[model samples]
Target chain A: MKHNPYAALPATVENIIVETSNITTFTFRPEEPIPFKAGQFVELSIPGFGEAPFTPSSSPAVNDVMDITIMRVGAVTERIHALSKGDTVGIRGPLGQPYPLDKFKGKEILIVGGGVGLAPLRALFFALAEEMDHYKKIILRYGARSPGDIVYRNDVATAWGKPKVDLMLSVDKGDEGWKGNIGVVTTILEKNKLSINIQNSVAVVCGPPIMMKFATIKLLERGYAPENIYLSMEKNMSCGIGKCGHCRIGPYYACKDGPVFTYDRIKDEPRIWD
Target chain B: MAKQLKQGCTINGVIEFLTTGCRVYALSQTDSNYHLTSDEKWESDRHMLGPHRPVEPLKSILFPPRQGVGRLLEDAPHSSPKPAAVIGVKNCDLASLKIHDYVFRDTEPKDPYYIDLRNNTLIISCDCSRPCDVCFCTAVGDQPFPESGFDINISPLPNNQYVLESGSEKGKKALDSCSDLLEEASQDAMKARDTARKAVYKTVEEQAAVKGLDGNKNYQNAVTGSIESHLWERFAEDCVECGACNFVCCTCHCFLLADGRSATGTSERVKQWDSCLYKNFARVAGGANPRKYRAERLYNRFDKKFNFFKKVLNIYACDGCGRCIEACTGKIDIRDVLKEALDEA
Candidate 1:
């Protein structure tokens, strides 16, 4: 029988983690292991509701279970937020292109994520942590709306803040008990005393469209080549393959050609921020 | 070998002969236009066999408006589909079918449902002896007659007989089975068929030239360059968002899949036709819509037809059939849009 690309594999929710009031992480053990790269995405479906594309938040090295971090936003996501352990759901793919970790070797990797966009970067961080010795430096500059919006707090505070890995955290606003830097994530770039070798450094950015637009400008102003900066693009996608034209951005189909594309490759396309 | 029916044979005789073995679908005349109907008897004096394309494109018969992609149970019984023969297919619709074949069957992981329907059906194409005012197949590098991709091609002669030619082995077999109803074509009939085909091409070419839609310029480059053109906003001003143009288009095959559950706890994923002109076509889960404005959506529809599909599939998604022009409630003519966007620019 021919494989139906739209058919979802039966999966059982193995675990659930509440990362924030609106964001939750659901772990599922599929009928088969969906081996994927750290930056790829999957279509998670709640059967009768419909399917929505999400990037896995857990390490790709962990094959037995997959973790998808979702924020309660629309109809499909509201249903996903209500899902608990032992509930049945469906998974379609480990779709789209992954980050080029091979190209990042022996170079300083600058990973910037804001809000729930940090989920895919977390997966990349875990993958890089496994091979920490392969690179000169690994830096993560993450920001969220507030301190309560910070995800993977324990890992960010301890595991990712080792001597070799420079971890910087900020928020748009702070509570009374908060003592960290209070500003948008880009402010950390201005406040940091560390200098990055622009010739040997590559930046990966994922966030809200506005954040991405300004962060890309900051990276370019810091002397990073357009080709050296990668951005994860999201659009309304169906048929995770290229058949459905929903995710199309100019000549590129975000589902097939990319959810991850270098800045230089798509700089000419219109309305990237929209 | 080319075959011919007698000089006085009516369209009803042909329909009866074609429907003998299996179901036959043909164009039946309606008040405004021709609609596909399965009624065997030719009830209307105004009904035509083959001169013009129908109001509905052939894609509706092959890939239905709504179809089941997945069932709740693994072992659900699927009924065997009845083999069908569709007659009066115009060359523009055939060209669109070629594009659809590249998308659904030629690509990786072929769609089983579309493949099943395609394999079970026989295509009977007919020549366009009369080109409509809106028809512009000549502008898109397509002829008013079928060049390929047909089971049987029927060319109408001057005296009402048809010169039937076979394009595939299946067509040859069908022709052979109906030998008793047909006769060997005469040289006079062949000459008349050639004259009629040439006349139709001339008419289409003259019409296209008058409208400045001769396909001379590089449409792909012009459309790609016009991303921010003010013309799109003007077009959006009159568009009602009824999606009638998309519904009547020959190659607008975008679809949305949803899972519907029954009270018995069984669910099926149903795929339904979707239009990019709709407001929510590109709206994502988190309310980020790339093509949010009606102007942007209008621009996207033309871009997909003229630019993106050509880049990916190496063929324009549109066949210049003009059904969209006929179906548009606002009377938005795509030929005029192309001329204004590509030629006038």
Candidate 2:
């Protein structure tokens, strides 16, 4: 009998964190720890509902438990929002290419995340933080629709906003009580006047298609090379092992070749933003 | 080894002889087209088992439309079909097995079910002596004759005789089983088979030329360059999205997996055929759809067959079987579309 790649490992919801009105973070303890690099994703399934691919938001260094931040969207995510602690779900991956942390060892690493796009970046952030002395510098520029929509509030305010890392947060329209930057995340890069050493730096971007498009243009204008920009692409990933052919971008199978790809690699791919 | 089935032996007699050791499926005439039928429908002289491809592709027999996969309940037993012989398979249909091999067997983590069916089924391919109006096998780097990928290929000759050529060890074994009904191919029979093959190739070439499809155009390059062509929208406007084209296609193998729970709480995962034409094929979370337009979906089907499969598998997915043209509800001919796209490119 051939090995069925669709089989899911049973996992129990260990904890739940409500990040916003529409978004929640579920921490699961599987029967076994799913070892994966920072940007890889897993196909999470609630038995009655269906499966969807998600990147773990927690550090890859953490064993036994994984954190998946999900925004309530469509059927599967809506069902996931109704799930509580101790609920049983299925997980099938840790598939796709991960962030090339080895390449950024001696270079400055800049991450730009918009909305829940920060989920994967949070994992990369912690993974990089573990090897703090290896990289030159680490920076994050994150944005959300509003002050209420920010994810990982406690972690961003306490753990991730340390002196060793430069953390910049922004909202499209800030509330009256908000005291942080009041424009898009790209604007924070300009307003803060952060000295980004483009020659020796690499930028990882993940967000809405429009945000990523504009952010990429901004990065290119700032003298960052095209090959140095990494993108976390989100397509309709059915089988996380690349057999389904749903997540194809030109000649690349996004599930296997990448959910993570350098900008130069995919510049010629058609309808990438779409 | 080459052999000859005697002129007096009826098609039903040969089928009966073959079926004594294995189940046999052959073409039986339906109201509109020919379908693969077993002993109950097989007739000696009633059915015309030659000259055209069948309505249902050979892929349906190998990789079924739907099958239960993964763990099953103790009460439910999955029994694979016994070893069988498939006769009257056209050369165009046989060509697609090469692509299916690349997909289901040669790929990593090979599909055991497909491999099992492939191992058990004996393919008896038939050469197309009379090309159909829509047939264009020559246009896609193939002739209306089987070169390989079959256990036995039957080239028809005059006076009810057939030139049988064994292509594999299984074929030679099957031929050896029925050695009493066969004889060594005479020089006259050999010349007749060669003449028949050349005649069929000429007719297929003539039909393709008359349809303006006989050209050395690079379909992969044409489809790659025609991604932005407006012709796709024009052609796709009439599409009803019934997905008959994909269903009838021999190479389209996209599938969807779903879990069905029984009354006893045992869950079974079932694999079902899926089509790219479906609106939700490319829809992701948060209501984002990449190929939302009907034109884009239509273009994707051709693009996958000509461009993507060629780039990945080193073979174009389409073998010019023309089943898609015959099965289309909107009468959208792939040949015309391909020709127009190549011309524009």
Candidate 3:
């Protein structure tokens, strides 16, 4: 029998966590365990509705259960948000290039995420936590629209906290009760605010396209080498195996060569920010 | 390497040989163009292979326009019929299998759907006698006739026969099964076919040069450098996003998956032809569309064919089939765009 790259395995929605008004975290239990690296994504199916590509928010360590943090943005996502617990859905993946964990060993790791883009980072967060002693430090600078838009609010500190981890949170518009800074995420990357060794630190960024573009420039300004900076180049990876031809960034497919490419690798590629 | 000639060969004889266990399709003359279809009754000699490729792309055969690529909820037994023999395939379409193979089969986790059909299908190519007005194969480092890459090539001779040459092991085996329909080729016939191929090549080269579409000029440099140029905006003015150029070009292999049902009415996913020319081709789930402007999409088409593929595979994706020039109702000529881009640089 020919191997069908598009074949989806059965995965039941085990739980749902409403992260925000628009974003939700879905925990699915696959019939077969899917082992994946941190930054790789999966194509979650809604049976009759169709499928959408999403990065897993759950730990790569856990194989049977997977958490996908998704926001209601389109037809497939709209139907995905409507899926209740115990609903069966088809899933295909562990696709695309994962974060370069081997390269980050013995170095400081700075994770920058915006809005729902923190989903794939959460997976990386867990993977790095498992080997927290391997790296020098882990710093996360995350921002959202407002206090209400913050994801994993219930246990971000408990789950992401470590001895060497420095976590910073911010919002574009803060409420009266919001004691944190009220500014964009790039503002947090200022000279006085961040105290990482520029040569020792590597930055991994994921977020909206505009946020990513600005964050990359900020990281560059902070003396982060283009090779030291990794970007999650999320295009419309229509076919997760790179056959669909939608996620082409220059000659590379985001589905195959990346979705986790270093800034230096794709700096010359055409319209990357787009 | 199996070259043979049939003294009294007919198109029906070729069709009859191919129709034993597989479905055979040949181009049926439709006005000045041709449509590839299985004919119940072919006209006396079926000489309507046409001077160039059909308006309908060859990709529509192997990688179907629409297919139910289902991930069945329930375990179901699957079966697919094996073979199809497509006749009178032009060199442009034949050469384009390189692009399709690279995208669908040469890459990792190969597309089972595309590979299945492509492997099962047999190509019976023919030497083109004349070039169409839209054709510019010589410009893109190609010839009117297929030098290689065909299973079997039929070059028409003056004696109302054809010299059949097998270019693949499959063609050699296929010829063995149908040896009764063929005769040994004379050295004179082989020389005649070679002479005819060269004559058409010269004519095509002269025609392409006249339009300024023929050259060894670096399309990669021109197209990649002109990303910020107003050339795209100017050309996009004449463009209506009909996607006829994408559909007609054999190299355009982009696709989109949608929801659909199979014949059993069971739930399934449908993967169909998609175009970069489409407004939302690069749009994600979010309201963000990278190629929002028509000009961006137009520029992207050239960038992929000229810059992207050239940098990666060292081959321009365009075969100069000129189907796009014919298919465009907006009358946006690709040759004119390339010429202008080269001139600007």
Model 3, position B312: C-alpha lDDT score: 77
Model 1 lDDT per residue over B18-82, tens place: 55666667887666477777643333353456568988899998888888887632433455468
Best-to-worst order by TM-score is 3, 1, 2
Model 3 residue pairs with clashes: none
In candidate 1, position A231 carries an lDDT of 94
True contacts kept of each: 0.51, 0.28, 0.63
Residue A151 in candidate 3 has what lDDT? 93
lDDT of each: 0.83, 0.83, 0.84
Once fitted onto the true fold, the runs of candidate 3 whose alpha carbons sit more than 4 angstroms away are: B6-11, B39-48, B75-77, B262-265
Residue A82, candidate 3: Cα error in Å is 1.1
- The TM-score that candidate 2 achieves is 0.93
Candidate 3 interface RMSD value: 1.6
Query: Measured against the native two-chain assembly using Cα atoms, what DockQ does each of the candidate structures obtain, in the order listed?
Result: 0.54, 0.40, 0.69
lDDT of 3 by residue, B1-345 (tens): 445645565756665665556766678777878887764433436635566677777888888888866545655345674687788889888888888988888888987778878878778888888877778888887778886887877787675767887888888788777777776777888888889889888888887787787758778888877777899999998889999999889899889877656567677776788989989899887867778899999998998999888887878898888999998979999989988888886
Residue A22 displacement in candidate 3 (angstroms): 1.4
Instruction: Please rank every candidate by DockQ, starting with the best.
Output: 3, 1, 2
Show pairs that collide, candidate 1. none
- RMSDs, each prediction? 2.7, 2.7, 1.9
